[model samples]
Target: MTGHAPRTRWTLRRRIVAVLILLLAAFAGTMGVASTLALRGSLVGQLDTRLVSASERAAHAPTRADFPGAVGSDAQPTEPTPSASAARPFSLRGPGQDVGTLNLDVTDGVVNAGYLDDNGDFQRLTDAQATTLAATPADGVPRTVAIDGLGSYRVIGATSTAGTLVVTGLPTAAATATVAKYVAVEVGVAVVGLALAGLAGTVLVRRELRPLNRVAATATRVAELPLDRGEVLLAERVPDEDTDPGTEVGQVGAALNQMLGHIEQALAARHESETQVRQFVADASHELRTPLASIRGYAELVRRLPEPVPDTAVHAMARVESETKRMTGLVEDMLLLARLDAGRDLDRVEVDLSSLAIDAVADAHAAGPDHLWRLELDGQGSDGDESDQPDDDGPSSGAGSAPTLALGDEARLRQVLANLLTNARIHTPPGTTVVVSVRATDDVVTFRVQDDGPGIPEPLRSRLFQRFTRGDASRNRAAGSSTGLGLAIVHAVVTAHGGTIEVDGTPGQTSFTVSLPAA
Candidate 1:
């Protein structure tokens, strides 16, 4: 499996869930805490009321017999006093003291104390804990004590009989337990509530965004379409249900659908216009062929006749013949372009490029012998590991090596070469040197035509391969005549053969580079 990046920040669903949970938790926590605190305070207040009642009862209502060493109401004494004879085991005694409570009685500052246990037996308080209780004053207000071996106490002290003080205390275990239990329940409920809310938020957010997803999918399909050339048919659109303009998502969907409609209409109109132009070119080229042939034949016949025609008339007839042929060539070029535009397929075959260059260069030299011509080849990395093969058309015949080959129509490829050479020959000066280089790599072959002549003017250089573009001045000014379709035809043919061409130049040097896929 491939590694994927994890989202560091929240998504839309997560953001919604987080915000809603935050608000919910804040509100529920405030209420739960307020109620818990209120319950605690109310329970503790009741406990304090009971402690006050015990303190008051001990102050004025205890019988005189309720003193240390007094016997129980229904029986004789069961336990002896701690101050009794040494022979008896030490025991603590009190007068009618009750279990289930704590009792502290002080006479002449001498203390007697014990705490009631679960079995109703009195357990004596440790001396250190007893001393701590004694230091408290006989005030009605409650106090808390951390007694040894006894968890916590809420205590209050008050005066009893003559110079005697009484202390009453209660454990706070029940009240503490009640508050803790309530808090636990509240936290559990809040956690469950937040989880459910987060789940519901994610579901709702996904459902609501479905329409937008559909819109994006449509746009993505359109983006993947090939729209650069040929007829374009854009038919994808936002669905009807999503196109209602009332809601925000609906508004977006409606707008996108409308834009797609307009684009389809525009493309349809453009395709129609291009079709009409192609048909017109095909028809015009067809109509002109017969008349042009007749004009040429009549001019040639007039020249051959020995009727002693005037020299001026013969010269005029020759010009007419030449112009007619030029016009016929232009028409044929237009017809070929129209057919290509109409998607006519060319013949596909294997052609050796190095040999083709030699032939084209020879023809160019014959046509314009004043210009110096040369051929360049790729022998840069031939370490003898790559065996040489013989090629009938390869320029490297004398060098005992094969040449670069490409998959294309032989006739069209030759036409491309002829156009490029003719373009260079007619445009560059007589003494300018032209070089044709054929280079082969693993998957492509490049044919570069370089020249040392007055370069293309800067104003026309950018559109040098566009149809009808003419140079400000031709290098061979004495033979300056052009239809301006040579480079354009070169571009169209190269492109149809799955190739690319680029031109670059400065004063005295210019290069036209063409790249074709190797067979």
Candidate 2:
């Protein structure tokens, strides 16, 4: 099977209008032909009736005594009279090979007659038509025929009182000529109508597509937005207020504008994020260099000593080792966050989150026994409503079950718990209770770590998850253990498991919530 490549194609409104016009013209032409034919038939019928009436009037007319002959024979007048209007001559033929003549005259508003020889051929008629006329019977009836001298005519002959065939002829050429003239006019009218319709259709089509043109122009301007330079400067958009929401063109323009807005916002966010990442990397490098240089300098001093080192020198070397370990830990945490930012995949398994939280709280208590630790595990089917608990109960569980079964990389989840526990341990003073609680629902599992320590300050809360961000400058100076990367690593690990972590801090309490998707 052959596959088609994707391509953009434009639809021309003018062509569509042209097609509609052609179809209408075709339908109109058919109707015109039908109407013309019907009119022609009616006119021809009237002409035939006129011919029959003239024949009947001639057949009943009184014959003059001076003209006498047998039916289908010729008669000649002894005296001839001249008149301003000359007679139109005609002939009638009988079935017995007899022929007669009639000279039609309209002089001074009176009909006159003359006779001519049957041997004279009709000058205007074709030979074939004249022969056909000559074969007709001598019966008294009107017959239609073509004459050599007269074109097409209707004729009738009957035996008069003088025993001559009284024949009358009416030329039909005038009726046919009139119809031909009408047909030419009809064709001219149709042509003019088609041309005007096409021109009008083109104008209408363009007017209808004006909105689409506006949309195209908007898109062109949007394409020139400075997204690469970390700036968004697109302004032109189709006006939603004026456009009809129901039309296809309007819908398309609206949808395009919506998509463009979304793209602009996303680009702005990405640029801001990139700037933050750069700053983080710069700060982290500066922090790492101090410890690294100290370790290197101490090692060099121990190697360059002229004699065996004293206890003071040995103690100095141990401090250098401790600083090296701290530096290594900080570096490892930063590397883990970088990997998570790069979307590195982690090994996933089913781990009991309840067990994990319990272990973390226990370790925090062990590290700082002066700081009170609380563990609340809402067992299965217990009404774990945190809202119903008394204020003195400290941290409580939400409405959910224990043993939150979550599918995730267990090591990463443990790391997230450890970071939260460590943050609570270092920030709070003695006697401040740190609480860890676990709750599960049908589709998600949540853990909350709250502390009654000097909660995070408002100004510093925004940067709590940022790498190397410390809540209190005094705390940083006092404790070298807090490298200010614990919460950042916690954020990375929780996010890697497709979870959300939130930090809410106030005057007397601070809580960190991590919610993960259930298995």
Candidate 3:
């Protein structure tokens, strides 16, 4: 057993939306990161400036017990010696650490101080001269140092006093947390803004694509058109009257509608040409049949004469005679169609189609003694009549009293049956069974002829009813028969009588059905 394949899927809409959202997200993310970095840098720079100013003021401050100017009746001043600890203001805090001071000793022309804390605290002096008071610096310059166990710091030497340095250290944790907080806020805003942007993008995309959707729908309806009808029924044309010609979709719709109009006109012309061809065939066939029939009859008469006809003459005459007969048959078939086209008035008598069918089948069986013939006449009722009066030429048995009656020409109808029977006899092999059936309802009558024979070849089915179209050309040549106008006449007559004929053929069986209006 074979399994069905999965259907193909399309994702144009989803892909479009996804791309738009991705672009918005990328833009938002870049902007948010840049903004956050700039804000954090500015905040940190301001904090660093404050730390430097506080350090400068602390470095220049006087000792805690300074006298300034003291007076006792007359101003008497005593020289004051600064305390060693106060002068240097250096306090070691283990691990080579110092508080309120920075060690500045030039060893190998390089100043080395272990570390300094944010509150003027330093530690981890590495040299003996690291704690000594050095000469006053000519210019104040802050140098960066790493405390013994802390992070990096900046220290500035004072110009007013020796060995005095203003120390300020920056902690990694505090600065890092401040920057992280700024980034977090920025990320949150970016996420929310990206979502809103995506929503807006979707709405904008749909609005922008609305006109295209209309164009697509119009195109789909046009594509579904039945071009064989020679007319386009696209009531909904793409509204291009007001659209800009330069727009992509507008141009497409305009071009398609233009093409459709051209196609419809071309189809109409083709249909007119075909109708003319069928008319010509029907007319020419009618005009040629009578003369051909006369020629064939005369030729046959000459061959049948016994007035010392030579053998060569007889053979030649026989050939001419057969050809004439074939040509005559072809002409008669065409003429029948042409007469129908010439609007030959129908007799319009209420004839029983079922009775006609039974007689036709019986006649076919009698003529083709080697073949089986079957008739199924459905004697169903028509309007206001339970019984149909059978004509003398019609069936006398099998068909019930109440048969399927139709409003038609009885002689032409019989001719139709004869053509069908002859066609089946000629096409099918000997001993093939032929089935003839008639069915009737209140409004319609149907006659069917079926034969069990090597059915019509597939290649010839399309043009089976066309004038001069023969299925087995070789057979026609061998039998010296068949002008190929029988089905064409059948089609024309049925159509003229406001009826329909159809053929279904396959290996071993072929069926022809004609449907007409019931009386």
Alpha carbon lDDT at 502, candidate 1: 88
- On lDDT, the leading prediction is 1
TM-scores of the candidates in the order shown: 0.62, 0.44, 0.57
Give the per-residue lDDT of model 2 (tens digit) for 113-152: 4333356432222324333443444475656666655456
lDDT of 2: 0.66
Total backbone clashes of candidate 1, pairs 3 or more residues apart or in separate chains = 0
Clashes of 3: 8
- Top-down TM-score ranking: 1, 3, 2
lDDT of 1 at 127: 60
Query: Could you list the CA RMSD of all candidates, in the order they appear?
Result: 9.0, 18.0, 12.0
In model 3, how large is the Cα lDDT of residue 67?
Answer: 22
Q: For candidate 1, lDDT tens digit of each residue in 1-519? A: 998999698776678778988999999899999999999889889888987876666666444434546323331122212221111001123444334467666543345666777776776666676666766678778888778788778888887755466778777878889999999999999999988987887788778878888988998999999876679989899998888887778899999999998988888888889899899999999999999999999999998898898899899999889888888989988887888888889888888988788789878877877777766666533424322322233322234335789999888889899988888888898877787778888899998998989988899988888887777445442323778888888988998899999898899899999999999
